[model samples]
Target: MALIGIARLASESELLEAKSRVTYFEIAARRILNRTKPNMPFQWTINPYRGCEFGCKYCYARYTHEYMELDVQDFEDKIYAKPAAADRVRLELRRIDRKDHIAIGTATDPYQPAERRFGRTRSILEAFARERGRHLGITTKSDLIVRDLELLREIARANVLSINITITTLDEKLARLMEPRAPRPALRLKAVRQLAQAGLVVGVFPNPIMPLLTDSERALDRLARRARDAGAQYFGAGPLFLMPCAQKVLLPWLEDNFPALALDYRKLFEHSAYLGSGAKRILRARVEKIRDRYGLNSGPLEYRPELWLGEEQASFELRD
Candidate 1:
């Protein structure tokens, strides 16, 4: 790991102890826009915030915190907002054709608690609102999105804007444990309601479909129904993808709280990145049935050897 100033660069360690509050500034040198793969329907993506404040117990994005010289456990409590992000967006946009598709918060929740102060994600959305023939996707668990209803509506009128409200489990108690710092599940559902009322195509992502955790067939079915009632276009879901740093915190949480499922999780992921082809096929088939029953049919992601050998496939089940 390298450090310029006091910023700690991430190292290839297996565990993360802690981090600091000192913020850092860096420009994202993104080139391509829309991306396509066998795993996901959309190809292009943009992640405004790096370390998420939500601190989801099973968050795979915790590895991203390592890049900043931090561990996955400290990823939630400590944050680093991008500097001059709006201007940087303008600069990046000026260089590319504005007609491409872009997805935000793919790696981290853009409207996390820190967003109330930084507002960089909101600013970037404002920039995209003025763009024509452009396609954009937003995945968040925050109701702060309701603040940009007018702008999002405007963008949807001219381009493509699909907002995916991620709800791993409908059980609020489980939600609190899984996403301690994130917005309440009810508020997130409200955000979906408000966005749909404004005529934007909304969806729900009951993702990284934690096996034996939040993957209760009835629980998932209920979530799909809730989103559908809120006027969501569809619902997408999959299985868990664990990362080393994330396991530092998440595995312990699992052992302490859901001890019954701990061994099952090990069987699913300890030996390899995936839960075996047969297991995934069964789970996907189950999800298909749940979505069919509740009408939460959306799309999914890709995981191929050419693009994502081992680590890449881990990201495919983002639940990051």
Candidate 2:
């Protein structure tokens, strides 16, 4: 097939390795830092890899692969690693304002399974560690992040760093079904505890809280309580939003797993990617109540690192 732009680059990428059904390719980085749209909490975003290996059924990021003209179903099967990630990030940081928040792993999990091999995420962090006064945030569903604890501590010393670990459910069976290749919930919580213990501003997010599946008060409360017990500084959650790419995967999985909810999911996400305002309000109330019960902040704790070189502390608003 004729390919253009990113697709062409992807097609020509050097084959790195393949395991099971997933293939890893090494692609050169053109740009590592991206500007977020206006009104977003963060000013910039960085995704070290083109595809996530976790293959979460409800992942909205599956559409990202479409930009390369690849089928959404191949989102997990083909992983693209940027070999020049560290150097690119270092170069891009020079153009960014120190006060603006930079979020890593907004579209792809920086610490995805492929990171163990490519270390692209670690490379980015290494670059961040050399800079001072920048507000940085990282979100991931993998416990492998703990492997870079020392590097994270170095970054935290000079930069305002917040880490968010996403743990959808404590139920191993359900998590296996939802996020087949991601780290187990307990492992993710352990990472949270370690990061918190290391004095990093860390939080737990039960993101994409599946309606009629994992959004019940009981389920959310359990997650919040466990997060608190693990020493997490904050807790947050958002209901699932299914774009077309996600619907193609999640809806069918729902039918095969929770047959009763499949039809409702199709109807709920038919028009928009977001849940209705009423549903969102209810979900917010539920998560807020759970946070209150667990004595957890709603987001990252207000913190200023001692080595902060910014004119003033950077305020990062919790989004989603």
What is candidate 1's lDDT per residue for 36-98, written digit by digit as tens?
Answer: 354544555666655777888877777666655565666775565544355566666666655
Residue-level lDDT for 72 in candidate 1: 69
Cα misplacement distance, residue 229 of candidate 1 (Å): 0.8
What local distance difference test score does each model get? 0.68, 0.82
Candidate 2 lDDT, 75-186, residue by residue in tens: 8999988765566678889988999998888677999989888888898898998999999989999999999999999999999999999999999999999999999999
Instruction: Tell me each candidate's TM-score.
Output: 0.83, 0.91
Poorest stretch of ten by lDDT in candidate 2: 304-313
What clash count does candidate 2 reach? 0
Judging by TM-score against the true structure, name the best candidate.
Answer: 2
lDDT for 107 (candidate 1) = 66
Q: Pick the candidate with the highest lDDT.
A: 2
